[model samples]
Target: MVLLKARVPRAVALLGCFVLISSLLTLTTMAQTTVTSGGIGVHILFQTNKWVTPNIHYKAGTGSWTTSPGVAMSASNNSEYPANDGWFQFDSSTATSLEFVFNDGVGVVWDNNNNANYKVSATGTYSVVSKVSDFKTGDLVRPSDGTGYHILFQPITWAKPYIHFNAGSGWTTVPGNAMSPSTYAGKFSAANGWYEYAISSISTVEITFNDGNGVWDSNLNANYVRTSPGTYAFVNQNTATPTTAPSIQGYVNGPGYSVTSASETAGVLTINLAVNTASISTSYGTDLSALVVTVTKTETDSVRVKIVDKNNKRWEVPKSVFTTGTLGTDSSSTSDAVDALYSFNYTQNPFTFQVVRKSDGYTLFDSSGISLVMKDQYLQVSTTLGSDLSVYGIGESTRDNFKMASGDKQTLWARDQGSATPIVNTYGSHPFYLGINSAGQAHGVLLLNSNGMDVTMDSGHLVYQAIGGVLDFNIVVGPTPAKVVSQYTKLIGRPKLMPYWSYGFHQCRWGYGSVDALRTVVSKYKSNNLPLDVIWSDIDYMKSYHDFTLDPTNFPQAKMAIFMDEIHASGQKFVPIIDPGIPDDNNDYAYTKGLSMDIFIKDTSGKPYLGQVWPGPTVFPDFFHPNAKTYWAEQIQLMYKNYSFDGLWIDMNELANFCPGTTCYDNPPFAINNVNSHDAIYNKGISTRRIG
Candidate 1:
């Protein structure tokens, strides 16, 4: 009976053991590991032009990845490479970077250099800066003779602004937008301001500044002129010979002849031609602004014009209209000119041309429409402010109203001005710019200051500045709008790429100090058979985050390379954060360097702007200054040279305004005091901008 009882107990114990084991197994099966078994992510194809599937599988966190309709993605030297397959964006004015993902599953990074290895983070917009077409010249130079017309060559276009030039002694200092060659800054010297261009778009020009006993004065009448190989429409008669060296002739205005201005600038050419003259016909800046009015003869009857723009690919209008009366006599001889009532056709949008005339107010015929159009539009010194908006049909005056729509037009404002109150018309107006076309391409303008401004497509905008306002902006024109914004298209933009290891995985927390603790984590990765890469050293790594100098206690014998080497061998990297804040302590290396160089971002008090960041209350670097850029670049160079790390992960470099977006702290060391300092380094590659 006792033996039978022992057998029954033994059987019950064995059954209990089986139940516990089964429960444990169930738990393990229910949980996920490095790899999970579940739904696959969105299926996609790479540049290889081959089919790839998660089914080809790699281990991931707690989940297994599998693709439906799985196929092996492959690439070789076989298939033709696709155009702009994949790209990375890294745009900053000074530096713009981009990387391409080829069809071969190969990733190539480019910024300061050509194709290098790179990675992408979350998928988004992308741009390719590689082999991007760039025109020879940039920005327009406004002339003081009268500040309306803007001329350029690349995609030859013309514009008229409230901009005007003034009569002066040396360079025509217009107090506003452009700089006269006489006052032009730098070593452009012989190749300085407003010289008649010798070639298309880009021509070696000269601009000189006269300090005390200057070479050339601002009196356009007295200054030397450079005659180009091109000829005036009427005088040349299509049979004129191309002259190697040409000279501009001065003529006298006669009765009924008026003035456009003393000087007009198109690109670098600045002309100060008077009312009318009887001499060989001559053209000024590439724009019609310099085609000074000279009355060969004036008549009671007026001539009508069917104007057009013949600058770009072809003329945008027709001929016929330009008429003239009989020729008049000059001091030396007689000539033909146009009459007073110069009526122009309203159908054509923008108009520019040269008029030939007879002396003493007699009428002269208008040249063919072929030479009428120019690059950019110019402001005409109208007898009256004719039609509020001349070229474009936008606002004519403060009272003129024009509607704006998201799809059709893009109105951009410069320097958000109104701040709730301050003046009677406290409605400090916003400076707005329009798209180049129905699609907003060809040109883009960002007026960088708070002023009453206007921007138009066919017509143009005007602005008012304070402190005698300096017309400053970042302007770009292209064949298409997409090309202009390939870098940072605020409307729709590309994205940055993640580091390869970053794609695999990243594990982090507040602080990570002590090599042993680091080693233990490394060992865990090895034992678990999981993939891990970065071991971030947060604030703890720095002695109060002063940056550059490391904490000996936290990273002893850092030179041994053992710590970094161990991770590297496993094909991983270490990243440390470097915020733009330098401690207030006088001894801080960064702070001291800034003070020594006069390069700290200053407040309204003309002292450095102070703020609090990760480390402590710190001073921001006045990166807008040239010296500051050099200093900042040096720091980056040191990181690569001294630290021997692969690359950097820049943070807090956006000049981000913390509490108030109204104030992003301005330091006027840039050329036009534009937000981007002349020295600021922009990522040149597409990927850099996106990642940033």
Candidate 2:
């Protein structure tokens, strides 16, 4: 797959010379802050050796603190302070005093003045001293033996510090090894007064700190987790009690549901569930008191299970979106459960369900252990996994492994992010995963919901935590991996076969400056005895990167037609990239036509949602709009009339935008593990709350 940010051309067996073009416009912006008169303006200076951005966690008087690790501070250009210092200016017109702390922005290390925050009453510059001595002026302190994973600890008070650790598998003997007094002048070492220990030849280590007499700091018994080979600070020092990490506020497990009534008809089971209100509310949203579950035997190998609020109406994926296979009938008259290729069993109170293979009695999915959480904005469910599990295909992420690791968290929220970034949501969301057991028996599960979610695989379980939508799951059972895939595709419609020539060597790049450059690239490939089947053009062919418009100077209509004739004669094809953002210009035919048809996504104020893209100000076509198909077809045909391209490269369909507007769905109460868990839902994408 070609990512928009960085397109890496695939190496094909047939050698080809592709044209490269330079983009004419580059977007760059500098942030400027303006301070109001009478507002408190305080500049903070901090020093550190680590190459990390400095940040400040600050609040005015008794106000709430800024989001951790707080707002980033800019590198100081002030001549009065040291050149290496980071600067942060606090300007709040209504504020009296400021209480703040400096950090490295990663939440790992901080300069908190020994846990007491810094305070200031007036506008001035204050220097934060985190280290005992400046490393720049003093002799640089290095580890006794540099090659290892190091941990620097500052105990509450200990005569001798020892470390009990494990690198990959086994643990060290008894009280473990003694630690040395640190002379390191790094960010972690400088801020945290040092008692250091090194574990040689290991990339990661799980450790617990202890004194020689057996008083231990095992991170409150949870132990410090594995981290990469680098000098780190042991921030937690609870020698008496086990360490407990902070939990998300107002987030808790549900009391689950109980089946108040159940019935079956024509191989379909419908159950009415009553909410168990015995547990505390999750507080993200009010829990529905009642829910309904429908289980359908869609086919011999497929089962569909859907859960939703019984009384109130809610949004669901439209039935017209995809073609689900026909629901099969069970002629057995004995029980609600039909004996098919798979069996569905359930418990009544604190509901749990299981899908098991009938032949081997192998459980494919079992939710017996975990509680089900369903709310207006949050939903969570989990299934137990077998010991010999090898799961694949919850994408579209760029992962290094085909089989997912045990401790992996995959977020499903489509965004216009590059595939080069691993373990983050990108371009498309596929809530399907295939799992195989030791006996090679495979099964597939598809959570047919479009809500943002984080799917975690850890400790013999697969958990789903969604911020919206129902728990609609489709399971396909197969005794073999290949058969499981076939069964899965049958249920969710098979992919369309591409044109035969598409499999051949295709040359493409962003910077084909003109028609002449494209022709030169094709000629060079032929001269070098390399096979070339298709030529592609990026946004360079468009007029100022506006959709459906050609650059009259570089790719004139007359010249393009002549070039098309030459390429057609050689059985070669041409494809041009088409971005979804329509230029909001009044003179643009496509934009005007779409506007008349009312096919553009609108902002909260009922005006067309204008976003920034290559075309400057743009509006996205609402594909969900009734007349969108007609308007889009007309625009594509108009472009085809100008350039006889063979295929269309739909780029940036993630509906990417350079600037997320004020009315966009920037924040939600429940957060998904979105790209690095730090980015907002509207980051580089349209608002999720918008609809046709």
lDDT tens digits, residues 494-538, model 2?
656777787777777655678987887788778766678988887
In TM-score terms, candidate 2 sits at 0.65
lDDT of 1 at 540: 52
Instruction: Please provide TM-scores, in order, for all candidate models, with all chains considered together.
Output: 0.31, 0.65
lDDT, model 1, position 29: 16
After TM-score superposition, the amount by which residue 658's alpha carbon in candidate 2 deviates from its true location, in angstroms, is 1.7
**Each prediction's number of clashing residue pairs:** 102, 5
Worst 10 residues of 2 by lDDT: 24-33
